[model samples]
Target: MKRRALLSSLAAGSVAALAGCNERGNATTGTTTHDDSTRTTTPTTSDAPTPPDTGLADATTAVFETRDRTISLLGGRRRLPSGLVMRAWLSATATADHPARVTATLTNDTEYETTLRLDEVPPFDTTPHASPGRDYDHTLYLAPTERHGFATTVPAVARAESGGWYLDGPPDRWQPEAVELAPGETLVGEFAVVPERPDSFPPGRYAFGYTDDPLTLSAWQSSQPGPTEESAFEDATPPAFAEQSPAWYHDATPETQAFLRPSAERVDAPAAVEFTLHNHRTEPLSGNVYDWTLYKQVEDDWYHIAPWAIPVPLTPLAPGDTHTWTFHAFSGPSVECENAVALGHLGGGRYAFHVNMSSESGPTHAALFDIDAPAVSVTPTEDVSVEREYRLVRASTPDDGGDRATLVVQRTDDADTRLLPEQVMRPRNRGLRNTLPFFEDGVQKVRLRTTDGVVDDALHGGEPERVFRYDGNAFAAWRA
Candidate 1:
């Protein structure tokens, strides 16, 4: 029989074996029946008849043994179809006033040994909310009667969607490593979650489970002793990027000096900041133009602002070559291009532009600049309520001919709103009579400035006008 078919049969048997087991309190035991004379007897709970002398019985035995060890490590009373036992409970350290620490345990209940291959450092990890792409890829070995546990501390709030279970934050791509669990031995791993508002968290009973299914056949196939070779079940590892010392570039026959700098020391928000890369080396400098990254400095830390897309091919810059790039200040839209790098907007602050030189670990060149607020300002005549959505309009006259303006909407309550650049808008007509949506539920302000600095008074000194305000149920126009 094919390996996949054999695994399917084993999985079915395991599920059948766990049908009547209780999930809450005590461990469940299952007995295996063997017939030596024919070597073809079927498991009591499985619907599929066991074929004679195909090693199905032996594989089933190994799976049962492996599950036994898993149960021992996890203290799991509940059985899973993947031939594993698991349990989740709140730790003693958790309290009503503090974040809850939830722990999940898995045990190996068998007298034999088994191994687990995982995609991450810890064999088991979960996200606070459901995520579709969670997967595993690291290796772990478990001896008979051994157990392993994973614990995470999350907010005390319960999730009705997950049946009152509190999960941890998103998974991190940590370096992978292997671990071993000996018989009757226990290993515990811990992870931390970012705490939510203190008032939002309340004490409650919650369960925990891995984001990815831990009982899949690929998780236990290596540990099963059967005709199938373990190597056949292994996944191919991705190739690692080449790394070189920084001095390698300097030591080259024709030394290359590549540096990035902004066109100006200070740029206005809603405007474009042009960056220039000058290659002052005897040899041609080759690198990917899309490898550039934009970083914003907050206090003492630099946070990376990811680009939407990156061009794939390498670009070669000859001696005395200069390349120019532009990023919209304050998160404005970019001019569309096939090879253009779509960058996020920048707010008023200190920023650095970095570009990779040769390889993944190659040295990077960076330039720094600052952004200042635009000249225009939006002042509200009355208090802006958070529950209402207002529309911004500019009162235009016949005398206002062929003039354009850019309106900037800023949220006063959130400083990080600058990271997202939807606040900038350029009205198309010269009169600037078009209305723009201001639907976000927050205390916000608007600034109106000329598309070009030449039209300074385009949107200012306008007459009283009527605009609509939405209050969840309906929209009402009020004259100001």
Candidate 2:
């Protein structure tokens, strides 16, 4: 019984880890940590971009902002920890149409100059000739240098990234290279990852997102041996990213109750924030990144400090039919400035969050209106009466997602609701596999909240939800 219980608990933890961004909290060992670079306060003569209304407002268009800080380009993953984004675009078919160029530039983001040696090497092996055929997983044409592989060291200053940040090539193409990023300068390089075998494969085929770090054996599943990230809880952490400088904190007392829905007793406060994106524009909405900014209310007009960001490469949000991009961020005073999850999207924008503390490089774009919408609350089921063997409540959604939509089930028999699972179910949209768990004998009020936003394009949508009741035996047949 004890063994089974422990295994069941760990299984649940692992599932929670896989759902959100790859945090050190995923595994019991791997811990990923980053340095906190939030500045105290810079003397600003002028550089603040005023918020503008772009007329793309939906009922979900609530304004939120947070504390601004500096983030490292590399040394970041679960998703790219380094901040340098690498995109892979291939020809439609396996037939080589575009020139294959495998190029890479190592920038020196330091004070001195640096050199980078880009080599095409296989993984290390106990025997001399056996390495190539073993260790590495994917098979493409490439050479090997050095006994093991290739190496380079580039010395440069801060903010210096190499230009043309890419590698272009046909098969037989892995070569290592490096560059120097000068002080306050960046060295970016790019080539083509065009495989020699193009149309021979197929059109609109598999090209990028092949692997997070396929170049090196990064994950244990892939035979890569790097330190994993640390855990969010402190027990089961990830490997590479561990407890670094910029540490985070949390709180659940009365101070933050004014914002988030307060629980009667102490409980976990994890927020499942999803982006309800509808690309109403002509172009296929996407870019090197899909940055989802979660704003906490800070000042009156300034909003709050930025604590959580849903950073991922979103797929091409086809023409119509809204797609929801989901992510989970734990909310407590320790990990945030306040208790609020306001999401925003930055697609095809010129400026990245490239702000420096000392005032050398600062300020970027001033978006007039939000391209994405705010998350709308779904209505609770209504009416309660006794019936047959099973008791239930219908799922309510602006889109009528029906019984399938996943919900964070909160069972409250107490008008003064107290202890219960902070987050019972993860909010997922797999098309109506959802069934609310009810245990009370009398009428029980059940609430179902949508994990993602509702883009009504119109502001006031009447409380953004419906309500229903759950009887002892079955749910009433009704629609909100």
Candidate 3:
């Protein structure tokens, strides 16, 4: 992305040649100053031919006359061949409370529609540097450096002080866009002049100027839209499991199957997987929380899958002791790392959980398993009776200080059932509302189950899931 380019043309002692001539045929000149006192010259009539009348209004008498202080136009407004007028102005005096301001406006005076490609409406200038000194009466005029684009010259009042004014830069994400103006339409922009240094800006006559590319008809017609920006994790790719695993674990030999193994060979996606590790060695085994890495097989290679919780220091397993561990599998990145890929939720695939033992000489162990597709299924049902199976129950009372409601999943059959975590619910075409799991279809029901017939209620506390019932009038919760 091309960030806003700074005003590189405002070098020391570089004067800005004012473009366009006023109605009186007087040309204005913008001189860059660094000294405490700046030299001023009277406006002189030029022999240059008069600029064509494009209905370009005089900014001084037209825009700034209402102000209490006097304001002068440097080169007057520039009227392009297409009748597009560009003008700028600055306040004559400034104080700490009301530092100063620069205003610029663009108007389309032609009968036909006009388009302009403006990266920035009012060009910004570099801060002026000059020490404060005795005030002196000096003439101030808004001058122009470049003809077409934003003005780049700092105002005379800003140049009169040791510390100049500060103006905010463009937003982090900005791009040039086409602005279409109908006949007689206008666009206005203002910049608040603030002192760069904490001290107040010395009171004095001030002038400002604008310089930018000319808004030509060719430039407007040829303008194309810029590329759109993507979010941080939008295009993230999953990282390889072996690349993220510890080098020591990859080099160690596989342990005997009896010491470490998964509870089942296959489990449903987006559900928890369980594993058992036995300390068969004569000594206790110790390791840290991050001693394990979970990987999912993609083709012949394995990619890393992030866990739900942060790793903690592991407790030492005494000889002949057994430890069981459970991990919730879902989609997305849990840990922040460079090139970290976020997998939304686990899909049907082969997976392996590798664990590293505390003993340096101990063999590493890996328990392989297969993740079946999520057991939840959604189908449309015309039967209104099915709606009674789901309800929206108030999870908290008003006295409890929380008025939140929860989705309650009622069992239509006698068989025991389990509801996967909210993260596991994936809607096909629309967003999934966790509290109101019901969708556009009035009787949409989801059947969720795990491989071992064990309910993992760690997240929902073994409570039946609840879903909202949207009636024609409004959404209401019903109890059966």
TM-score top scorer: 1
Which candidate, 2 or 3, would have the higher TM-score against the true structure?
A: 3
Compare candidates 1 and 2 on TM-score and give the better one: 1
Q: Give Cα distance to truth, residue 75, candidate 2, Å.
A: 16
State the lDDT of candidate 2 residue by residue for 1-480, as single tens digits.
Answer: 342244334323422322122222210121112231211112121211111111221100100011111000111112123332222111011111111212222223345533322221111111111111232333222111111112221111111022111112222222233322333333222122211222111111121122432332110111111113331232312111111111111111222111111111122234343333322221223322244332221112222123323445533322111234343334321233233343222111111111111111211111111122222222222432223233444344444453332232333332321111111111221111133444345424333333233211011132332222322232221112
Query: Per TM-score, what order, best first?
Result: 1, 3, 2
True lDDT of residue 66, candidate 1: 13
TM-score of each: 0.26, 0.22, 0.24
Name the lDDT value of residue 86 in candidate 2: 25
Residue-level lDDT tens digits of model 1 in 125-241 = 323221112311221211011011222221123222212222222233221222233333323322221122212222111122343422211111213212121221123221211
**Which ranges in model 3 have alpha carbons more than 4 Å from their true place?**
1-258, 270-272, 308-314, 328-344, 374-480
- lDDT, ranked from best to worst: 3, 1, 2
For all candidates in order, the CA lDDT equals: 0.33, 0.22, 0.36
- Residues 96-213 of candidate 3 have per-residue lDDT tens digits of 2223334455677788877665543332223312221232222222222222122333222233233333322211211124456667665443333333333333333233323343
